[model samples]
Target: AQLNISGNVTIHRGSETLEDSKLVTELHNTEDNAYDIIVTENDDESSSSDEKEEDAKQIEPNRIEEAFQVKYQGTTLETFCSRLKLFHDEWYQQIKPYAPYLTIIQSSGSGKTRLVGELRTKGIYILYICERHECSSGYPASTPYVQKILETIRDYKFGALLSIAIKEIKNKNWSAEEFWNIQIKDDHKAECNDFWRSVFKSLLQQKKPSSDSRDENFVKKLFHKASIVCCIDEAHELLAKATKAKDDETYFVKWRRQIRDISWVGFFNILLSTSGKIGNFLPPVTQDTRSARSHDFVIFPAYLDVNTMDVLAPLAENVGKEYDYTRVVYLGIPLWGSLAQAGVSLINLVHLASQKIRNFSKKNNDHLANLACMACSLSLEVSPRIAEVDSLIASHMATALGVSLDRTSILCTYPSDPILASGALKGIIDVGWENCLDTLLELFSRGVVEAGERGELVNRILFSKAYADAVRECFPDSPVTYLQKVPLKLFLKSLLREEIDGLDELLNRMGIDEAEIGFNHWTSLLATNQKYVESGGMKFLTANLVIEAYHRHTAFKMPLGFPVIDHIIPFKYNAGYGIISIKTRIQKKTTFGAKDISSLIHPLNSFGKWKKGYKILGIYIDLGLDRENAVESKAELKSRNAPQTRSKNKNNEDKKDVKNDYDQIIYIQGVGSFKCCGKEISERLSKILFTRPWPLDTQWSEFDEKTDLKREDVIKTFLPLVFEQKQSLVDKWQLI
Candidate 1:
């Protein structure tokens, strides 16, 4: 009878004893195959019974000793094994039928390689390949990859399908010597060598040998069996490099396409494991056209919350009594939730806390170190809240420091409040509210607190990772202080100090004894001045208000010419004074003459000489009658200090003939320069000129019913006249 063992089997033919190596080798050499040898029991019943009793006595002690020893430590590995088995079973079912390719996209450190290794151990024939170097350069060329694939197929002994394929290749035109004796060359033409050529040519020429059932079955199995799996780890690099190469006919591209084609025939399956960059490397046809046959599996690592709790549970149980229970609970549970919510990665938090702990242990300050680790972990949780209030706190600190709020140094100070630290970060503190600000300043001045490279405060005594625990150690029962409210006056002053120009001067001016000016009056003055500034006033001045008031007092009837106002004049109601200079033409002599002699001969012509008086009267009327009145007033004033009769006779004769026939006609022009700081005065004069409706020389009416003009329109009309006057003066000076 023949006995068959399916799994691991151990045969015990005799007692446990050391075997001689030479005798064992000699026994294996005597038989064709050592595994086929069989052993027979002794025929003597008494001898067999004695041997069985001895074996039983020896085995019982060994079995009991082994049972007392520790077999397993924890269930972590067992849990992983069960999950991996389930994943494998599910994945195998999905890829079993006609699926030609399977791609696994996962992040780094997700145990992709380990999972594939486990599958290989379960009797799946996996041909593993990794991109170790640039395939286009150096020793390990593309030829080696092709050779590895062939060698894997040949070495796989789980099935006879590959063996049949090789036999079919020999039966074709490929000679036996060439089939078995071919070698891979290290060159670009390595794929064109006899070995690879025969493999591809044989695959292409596959056909049924006969119509019989056995041969047809063999052919079907050779093409459809999924016995081999090719695993390409980090396949993104390999495929990406091939796509980026200069030549369109590179060996890698050809080999990859060929393998894909072979996969479609259902010869084997391809499992590509990459770090999610495989999509950039795959061809368009492979991605879209063959989507039905290709499958993708994305695997994320286990959740952080579950893994963290599982890891800490054992440590907490073991050290629960030795450490402070509150601190232990903080480190193992609450700290993780806080840090995670604060946007710190779990991996980074673990590394940073561990490093801090290690450093403190090295200095023989384990207790302080533990507290520091706790502080560091908690500090990250509170950083975002600190950042939110940083500007407001800095503004307050700047006020306290008597510095400009915008100073980078003042804005860089770290400000802490108990409300923020406790409510936002769940932090613990030990400090007195009294003199807390003073203590903080003192620490900063003494170099205990530090600043980061960007000038932001780094080591805050209340919440900083490096110093919070130290503060707690020094004053264990100290009360935490909430930030005090700043005074309303000071707060408003801080906010408006930078934006308001000449604020102190304005405040001082307003503080003077101005009880005569009511609050409403001052508000109206300020509001009107603000409008002037917004209307494109070049400069704001105290004189602006006074000028606006003067225009309003005069009923806005100012003349077309610029008005010169003295700056020294007080803003009092009756202090208004002005000076005006006028120039006029004067003739020294007068004469009478006739142009036609015929008027002397004729009777009507003889009276034409008297017509000159009517002409002079017309000239007198053209120069307004006010001119004669102004001349008479000047004569009367001069007569008071001189001979009245003589002055009167001189004025009467001069007024008789305003137009002189013999005297030369002279014109007098008055030019004046005025510098004014107020836009309201200028705009008032511009409005008077702009209201002269149609003609340029039309008189302006004070009672015109037109609406008020915009300030822009006033500026546009006034600027050109001023520019023209300036240009004419410059030209006159140049001529002079």
Candidate 2:
């Protein structure tokens, strides 16, 4: 009993164990079978023939015991076993008639291989295959890999017969891989598969009963009795070529097609593991994650959480390491945690963590760049920042990533006050990994101050103010520097440094702010001159607040051509400041139809020649005044600024003749790059997007307000007297 128990437990994965000599001998005796290259060493000095013969006859033997250091076994080792066993019993065996497979999603270096080692420590038979190298059997359908799997089962059966399961350091059956991949051919394939299957059936194993008469409970129990499991390391590599595995043309509409259908992959009891996002990997219709087969293989997330930190920092309770708990839980990858075990200071660890995260973000297509930016924007607050996310994903983050407080916040984020690391994800990018777009929408929705609903979080989305320092260390730019850079999520926050919103007020709040630094707003978003702040340095704004932002940015890049650069300007004003946007139109018969005119109502898409003029709605303002006619070529416009004479016969194909007559053309005298529209277009707009609308040709500088204007406050100017409309007509005006 003792020999059978813990028989297969190796001190570590890479143990130095030679193959059993008996198996090699037996295979050598088999027809066309040979293995094990062995060599005998002779002493340099030629020994006497009689002495050598005596030594060989006496069978000289050497024995030694190797010392092995047992690393920290996490507190959740039993939990790990329980989770896998439960999945195996309940769901894994339920489909035993078909295929039994489980997927374990774990981040890289989170001890996934070690966890399998732990199961082996209990004398469980596990065939670990490195998927990247060994999954392919050189056959079209991986016949050799599967054959080796059966052989591994037979080897275990031999161990059971002897009541002594041998433990080896090697992660897999290397000999099997060599023989199967190199020697096995299509001609002998059927014979080889038959031989392996017969050997597996005769092995001392728990025989699974026929499903015809066995009850569900009986079948599950039989599965539980069958302790053998095949775990493929880096199983996600099998999926790298494909997105979804099931009934789909392309695996994913967003990703590549022409991939294999892995939906019917479960040929035997298998465990597919990865270190990517669970929400992203599982197929929905067995491919789409949103509707992944719940009845299918279980998604076991082996996250490195606080228990891991406790294991690393055992004396954290006696010392003052409780304060650094959150930090370790968040950034305590095994490699970094080992540094903590060596008594590295918390400050050094934090600096190290910040650098690693930054470098990682930069390398992985900068998917986490927006997260870093959001962290910086919210870093001035004293308390830990929190945001809601999808409950299922949030649960994974909490347990696996160790970010949850109470273990359940399934609505948006798991645990109402989640671990601060919850904010970082790759969901926003088009070509990057999974994202958390909905999370951003949820957080921003609550942060809307202008909304009469006045949701929780009031005007602010709580975030660690000290994280701003981390962001600066990583990305060295202001909070709003990445607005257009992030085409997906438009995050906005206030820059006003109110004493009440200080970190000191949030001390009793969430944890993770071990630095406990109180920050003041030392950065300004806007200034009058270009010498002060750059256009990229402004605070983020939504569609409604975009006109002001458009004007500010226009001060930098004047005369932004069509498809109006007004995406920086927003038409919607529901969120705190207004969400700005830009739009493009599909023309009807090359004629500006009602649809074309109507497309501009949304402030983001409206035709506003950025910065100077009114945030025009309803129509494309094709300015048609000779002195200020918008030319097709920028060089011609520049030449006009210098008062260059026109060549009558320049053969300029770029010249657009403005022929159609319209209702109104509000031509500003000095402002060269401005927009004007017909009377119908003007009435449709009716002074909506901008703060205050005025007649055409008014000095672009007249409506400008610096400092004290509440932003919404209309400037009371000296030129209140309305000027009579005197504008250029659009009938046959040749603009060069």
Candidate 3:
């Protein structure tokens, strides 16, 4: 009777292992076969145990011990085995009948390969392939770069046996000199090479009657009998081809389709697994015309849900327990940009800001910090600075309500005290408190702000894995003193000491006080200007307030124009006095003043054009406009601003007698820009996306060529640049 072993087996038939000696010769030799056998030693097995164990005491070799179990964190065996078993059982059941193409969405260090290996050990033949040169700590063999997987399959069976034999010979502890001394014949070497190929080809083409068969070949034959599961790792990278892959189409996609419809094999089990990504990759499923068989699709996400961040907490904890827990200090500044330019923006802003703080603290110089403080103050004064305030209030409300707070005045305001300015910081920017509240609430509905019960505000950039940690790492000792102590009052004070006093105070001292006096009344009062405060201050104040109001009101809930430029004045508004704007439209077809619309299109006048006597209303590209008399030539614009001139000739009648009329023209006089009927194209696109109002999905690539706005690069580069410039300007002028 043949006795079956319960535990691991050990090979102990001691035949002196030789140079390039096959493992099969060491084991029991089969009829007309000379193949190798690979074995692992167990703790209880001896090196030579062929004789009766009762008569001879078996001694295990010290060099060989039981195979070690793969452990988590280098010590503890993970308890995830039960969960893995359950998941695998469920998966096997669901995918057994149909040809299932699965995408397993998992993050790094999820033991994906090990689980697959264990499944293979359980008799499920999985043809595993991974990306070439894609190295991760958990997996040893990265993906094999073999062009053809069929070659790998053939070699896996026969080549593994050869490797085992070669390794055994190499382990003899003989030095190179002694090994070379032993003569091996050329015929013997040629025989070894031929044996390798013959065994591989025979096993791969298992239908052929075998003259001699090995144990490895038997396993391959068994595997080929049924549908094999091909498990691919890093499937995302495979699918994403920058140009073309093996063909004009993406290799991974094309290969997947080919594998799915392999006519030679009838519905072999196909499984594709990947970590769920929020990107476009998977191609639409094609219909099967031949047989009634079709590929079934399944997707598994890495993350559980947006609301719960703790679903993967256990896995994270397991890995982090050994390694240091990720320490992060999130700086939640409001910003967004293109994907390509994101890192640049974060580097420029985060690193530069951090270094500025460090340098200031080290040098005991408060000038730079004070400058930043002033800018922050000005922004606070001009804008509501709703992000921090609302999030703070929302957090407080959640505490009071004993639930997660939502973004509403009820959560973001003092519930007991109705007026917000009473407790929190206050400044009006022509935008009413009610409207500000609505804006904040709208941002919440859009999922920009989350109601964290804890002090943690959603740092969209930081919380996002792409930049947050990397950025934090980039700035090690970013002293928080500047931002931490940055109260609005202190910021305003810094503006006075550093910026406003040096310039405007000198102006006031020089009796350019008319301009200086007007500036003070219009902007925030610098401390130096308070001494020379005059009665006519209110006139300058009214003008500035009106202009600011025009811009705020016009742009509110309205669309802007293409190549959007909000020009203040044809000339720069530097004289410190406020500006005014005006617009005029000619009467319908009756013809009007010189038909001179030339002054409107000049780059200088393209922005702030003010006319005293004409009707002011908005105009659109109306089809009703009289095209017969309409003049749209360069010569017409050239003569438009010129003073009254007679018609040059009677032949110029068609040009000179071209009658003109305007429907309506909207203008914000000195404010220099008009607001139209829709949201900004960029903003509209964002709303359609992030909010998902429209059925069409938004992509950064969509606007790459369509708009002049390097939406991607501009957001990344300009936002932070504009912030710096405006901040510096505000500081120098003390406009907080």
Candidate 4:
């Protein structure tokens, strides 16, 4: 079988894998083609796992002859060319500072390089794609910028055009560096401009070697073109490297002068390309940084537009993974599209962007996770931050994204607080609360966040800028404040719980001890699946019992937290699919009373129907100090009022409330595990014990035996109305 190699390779990040027939084969047949798309490897200074994957996709056979991949082969490329030819001069003239530079500040991997290369394929006359890539990280990092530029220029076909223009149309051509000094004159000086025109004309003639007459006409039209676009790719990388040395111009400043010189020519326009949520540009040698010997250029601005996501959705799927809001959060930064293409998952990529963000090191933040969870509980949809459209520039930016740019409408990007030209879009879209909650849970998975060694019970959690950004991007900006406060008003009726307007009041402090840390973690786990409390008006007994539950967890050396609604609070930790209730020293019936039951359904509806926005998983009541009087029980061991056995008919008046309103109901005794002294001193104790709390002769009861636990050390009383959803906690949530 003939091995046909398509240009696109299905690369698996650090491990290079070919698409089905993916192979990196070198074309030993580059001699015949004018636009040679050859693949080459560049040495990278980073870890072995990383490569110059972006440029490695395709490199020009001849480094000096910048070739573009015809990604927008025909229609898109043609439109861009026609537009550039028409507006290059007009765009320059309209600018206030009038630098005559096209100034296209594109983000990384948005195909600015491809745009440069495509101009060549279109047979544009005066276009030049500089090979001096500003991302000089690999072996090229050691080479001076000016020296590199000189070397690349030294390779151009100026010599060929000089022989044809200055003398006659002969086959003998020489390098431009030999005859005209571009190092001194810049690219667009009067004499230098004419020399490059001859190069383009000759190249065109060579393109159609046999059709001399047709070549002559085509050459005339292309050469006589009024505009020239000099694409200085990765110019932002150079701007940041700018230094203010006293004696002479630093390489960065020298490069800046070259750009300025190129822009001064009336016929020439320079497109300054870079990427990110770029704000206003400042002079490279700002006074504040002038005296500094070293500077930090790091920024981790990860933002996403749902509309913009559509543009990249297909590309992401092709790489064997589909990105959701959570993926977008961690992988949505600049070059994220390309990184996804390469199948890499380096979260630290954002660290190298700008020094203005956080330390980039990740750690657990229970408070942050709770804040995110709470916000999600309170809101139904996230209000997206849309970038403003600058009628003119946005349209042009749209062209890059292969979208029809309209003066009135476009996709605004997330990084764009001050939208200029970006991956921006304008539209109305809602991020549902369910998805946000799911993303939050996926991010803060207790299993994923843990101690550094071989199981330390609980290590740092995966609560980072990514998760918080998602909370901001996915959840509504404010509490779904439009929500009717009547339920909240009634929810507030319970004198035992306090009010928390927002996160500001909810936040405690920055840091806490590992004891509290484990407590909070355990609390989150149990809240998902565990029991609640109730007893006679035995105030001191109940208090001691609840305290004992806390002490038991601390003694067991497990992630610690109270058995209250949320570890220690009497509110919903997560809305709908959440467990909420209040604790008090009220008279306890053999079964929980209606008042006690209402605690589980607070934020409930007025019609006695549980019609609040959120859904109830079940009621968790901890009947601290309530000893199970087996001697006084019925003789039919199974005849006891176990939830499921007692109620099959939802129509039963008294049972209707529990059956129709709740998904599950769980009951338990408070305060036990303190028995595991020195915390069950094991090499790596299983957290399975966290959910399986033992009573001081503490206990568990049961409903439909299908979903109840009967561990020797634990007592579980479970009534699951819905078989699938109402399983034991760990299994339902996939905690294992």
Candidate 5:
């Protein structure tokens, strides 16, 4: 052709590979401003795999300074901002001239604080009041008291408002600490007065700073003129405090009313700023009030929503593994029968499951695993109580849900006494049940579980509904329904079978060997043994089976004529006895005598031995064989040689009543709550009271050394009605 060498050329002389090695030269002298170049060539040997992978991950220089992604309610920051009214535009059109009644509404953690910061930077002076004293993570554990607000204003612009407030507090010789002291006195009044004055002054001031304005005086004036936007974070706290008025409790009611009135007056002044009408303040909205206008109110509360959840999820994932929300619905199976019986939401279920895994890690002291499990558990919504009774429930939920132990760590938590915070749980659970509602709400807000609405739980059981239905389907017999007439022992045994199995088996197998301990642990066995008897397997099996055995063997007495189950070392030593005794009393199905003594009765001798002291009165049995040695008072017993309170019908009839019909071992008498007595003292007294089989109206026969009466006889007579209760010894078991 025309010999176009520029288009193509051959560099190799040989014909073997001249096509593969092309060499060409351009004939044109000028270059175009913009041109596209393309060429095809055979692939060369690639870089090593490791190097290639490294290069792939390397960030390019051009990608720097790109805007970070901001997620809010499943929307981008720019998108959200586009929809929200701009601060300046909003102030000018809706808030500015009103002298400052403005309300901002948004879920918590949604850039509200940042927005406030921006407004301050733009020279829009504001007053901020959060519901809580500080953020959840902030210290000293409560919202800042009203006193702090009165001391600082200028520093609000620097986001050092709290710090400045603290400084102001010190300047005024006050402390935030004093507010929470047990003894709140004059200091509280002073603080309240100071806070009131500060708030009043802040609301009333109305001026702006200028170039030639006196600096200190000008800031003060500007602060006064600024429209106050009392931002209440965790507004629920305020709402809660306002609703707790009692009948005839005018002080708190008056105080709350006054506060509302003040807030209303201030709000009206700001609303009528341009019109200069200070009389028309808005009414304060407590949570009890269903509705309130938001024209000038600003609140940021801990509310749960998808966007907040999304932010929380990633953090949760970082702490643990990602879990599908649906999986939580079926958590816990073995013990609860299914997730339905557990009555927990999916998130809560996951949290409970995760808690169990963490518990093992903590018990074993595996630092890394512990940390991981802890993080995972927290991610799933489990708290830090490593080993709690809730583990049983949590483990069951986890098994049902099919979540791995590590992932489900968050589900397990203490099974609060009340099902929720319903007052219906009065005697069924413990006192102070209402205090847990706040914690429950916090858990709900954190996505642990849905809170109860009104009086009912928000979530229903998912799979074990049938099991629960079956339970509700069954009804107790008339005999069983009347729990009081039934022997307490029988009721307790049935309860044991239902609630505690191992104890039931052990108690069944106990025989004489278990009795060797003299029913020392009865308090511990109280719940288990009582439940065993209550469910109805057999009769004569009270929680007191073990203690009754001992009662039959010994002889000591007290005033009430019922066996006094006292602590050995006394609960006051560690307060354990009081807790144990109350727990035992509630759980005991039969009288106190038959309850397991080992658990209930610790060794007071342990304390005594440690104290290097021996018994002042040597421990002994009141056997009638020593009748001749018996004595009552030094005066009465010296005169005769016979048993005290002997009946006129001294035949076997009275002795038969003592031997055959007698139920109680000894009588008990004490004025205060007996959280701290010992078993030895109690048992000794029981024998004394039961041995003689004396009546309150009976008189002494012989109070001498030759008589049956001895020095152990202290009381002469007592009432019998105090010892009355259900009489039974039914032995049964129930699985709880």
Candidate 6:
């Protein structure tokens, strides 16, 4: 075995090298060919797979790009491109010939920015000045308008061509500022000037490049051919702020001038987009001088057509089962086929319907629940506004079914309680009574309440179909067929009660004391009216009770006739004689002044104009005591006294007169005279005399001399009675 192993080992080191090298060569060849074997296997697999793929391609063409295509309202970008091309052709022919500047008046949310972005993406040169960007957080507010323009140009790649042209004109290294400021001499730098002029001239020409090459010369030529449209988005804000800037050449004005300079070559264009009327922000120069040479175009979203309906059908259906194709299409058309708007409207409708469903579920009545479900279903089919819903209901469901369903009642029924309807009606009435009927009609039409011809709700109470039905069921014998048959006046009475409670609440809120005066009066009036109503009175209680109560609570008497000494003496004498004559007349007519005899004979005729017989009697009783003095004075006057005695008597009488003049005398209208000092008389008389007239006469002076009377208090007491008498006298005289 040792001999065999030694022979197999081949032990000679130098001689074994040849065999080892051979083995190494063979191993290296195998390792090197291993990669080729793997490659061959892979190549065969790839070839077979490629053939299979080719076969598959023949069967079904590759549509990877088509699979990723997004359509807007079932329209492809190609379709839009074609439409745009047509529009551009027509615009160039009809409008661009006369005006290079176009003002686009677009409705809110009409895709103006999107249009500009799409045009820019399609290789149209655009200088986009978005007013919204100025307010955005990322925008650099302090950057100059000129810098912004340069940055936007650079960003849009148009600045590359402009920079090349500037470099050619300068013919040397120059900064952007320096390039902008460079002036070309007519003779010395004629070629540089011509190149610069041609650069702008080409831009203004707005011609499409003949070649699609991107070489330096071709880029320059393309820029020259292409129109550079300056898009001013939210142009209203831009122009407004621009004009308001304090600089001599406002940023807006300067920008306008720059645009004008470019556009003068007839290739450049200005596209101003505003969401408001174009006339509002249009510069005075544009209006008066027509220097801008602008054409106006009002851009609106495309109206919904059949194609739009088809595109939106899936989305609308996804919203809910309630949104049928017809409903979606109907709403879509008015909203201009805006998917976002349609989505929002559908969301709001669903939310409202859900809320209404929840509310109606709480009604605890099958009829109301059914009504709620129906209304919710109908709401999804109709526009959001109640008026639109009403029109639809009237045209379709109401007329077809011959169901006299009140739209307002249906709308109001969506609320969990009838109180909401009542409150709504109250609110409408509170705004103005004149609008009550119209408001009720509107509410009825909106399905907030049902109404009769006179605008009464179906249920006497708003949104109370259950209560109304219950009443009808319970009171089958009653003449009332419907709750609407209940009188409006009864509703008014209920409203009055609410008003009373509201007034009470308001008064309570005002802390009682602060509102005492008005609250007291109102409470008393309301109590009286409420009592009248509760007593089964049909009509409103006349304001007679209120008037009577007012008068009774504020009862006062004003002193009537002036206290003239001349009138007082004769009035006293007339009272005496009138009393005597009245007694005689009454005694002669009958023993007692009974009504039968009193009517036959005017017992007080002898005392003419003295209807106050007691006053005359009191004055006469006082005058009877003075008759003896009168008789003694008569006897003394007939005695024929001496001249000196008579003179002395006259002097004594003059002294007495002076004393009487200083004495405070109060002449009560129905009472005998009382004489005292001024202060004493004032104190005594103030208690009886309620009013002190302005510009006090002797009687008022007799009272006001001592008391501190307010002018209002005096006027309140006297003015009413005085005016009342004046009115009465006028009426009496008129009657006469």
Clashes of each: 0, 38, 15, 39, 121, 15
Pick by lDDT: which candidate is best?
Answer: 2
| C-alpha lDDT (0 to 100) for residue 358 of candidate 4 | 10
Candidate 2 local lDDT, 614-665, one digit each (tens)? 3322213222222223333110100011223443347754544432122111
Best by TM-score: 2
Could you tell me every candidate's TM-score relative to the true structure?
0.23, 0.33, 0.26, 0.32, 0.21, 0.26
> Listing every candidate in turn, what is its Cα RMSD in Å to the true structure after a full C-alpha superposition?
39.7, 26.1, 29.4, 23.5, 30.5, 38.8
Off by over 4 Å in 4: 1-95, 102-112, 115-227, 236-245, 250-281, 284-310, 315-736
lDDT digits (tens) for residues 514-581 of candidate 5: 21111101111122244554774222222233223222111111111113222211111111111111
For candidate 3, which ten residues in a row score worst on lDDT?
55-64
Off by over 4 Å in 2: 1-70, 90-98, 106-110, 132-226, 240-272, 275-282, 285-318, 321-335, 342-359, 363-463, 466-736
Number of the candidate with higher TM-score, 3 or 6: 3
- lDDT (10s digit) by residue, model 6, range 345-386: 333222222222323122222232233232322111122323
Global local distance difference test of model 5: 0.24
Tens-digit lDDT string for candidate 4 (531-625): 33232221111223323322221111111232223212212221111222323211244464554444444434111235444433222323232
Please identify which of the two predictions, 2 or 5, would achieve the higher TM-score against the true structure: 2
- Which model, 3 or 5, shows the larger lDDT? 3
Q: State the TM-score for model 3.
A: 0.26
| Order by lDDT, highest first | 2, 4, 6, 1, 3, 5
Task: Report lDDT per candidate.
Answer: 0.27, 0.29, 0.26, 0.28, 0.24, 0.27
The reply for model 3, stretches above 4 Å from the true place, is 1-70, 73-97, 100-102, 108-111, 114-127, 133-140, 143-145, 150-230, 237-736
Model 3: per-residue Cα lDDT over 417-517, one tens digit each: 10111111111111222333234334434333332211011111011111212222334465211111112122222212122223334223323223200
lDDT score at residue 151, model 5, on the 0-100 scale = 27
RMSD of candidate 6 to the truth, in angstroms, is 38.8
Off by over 4 Å in 5: 1-88, 94-145, 148-230, 235-306, 312-736
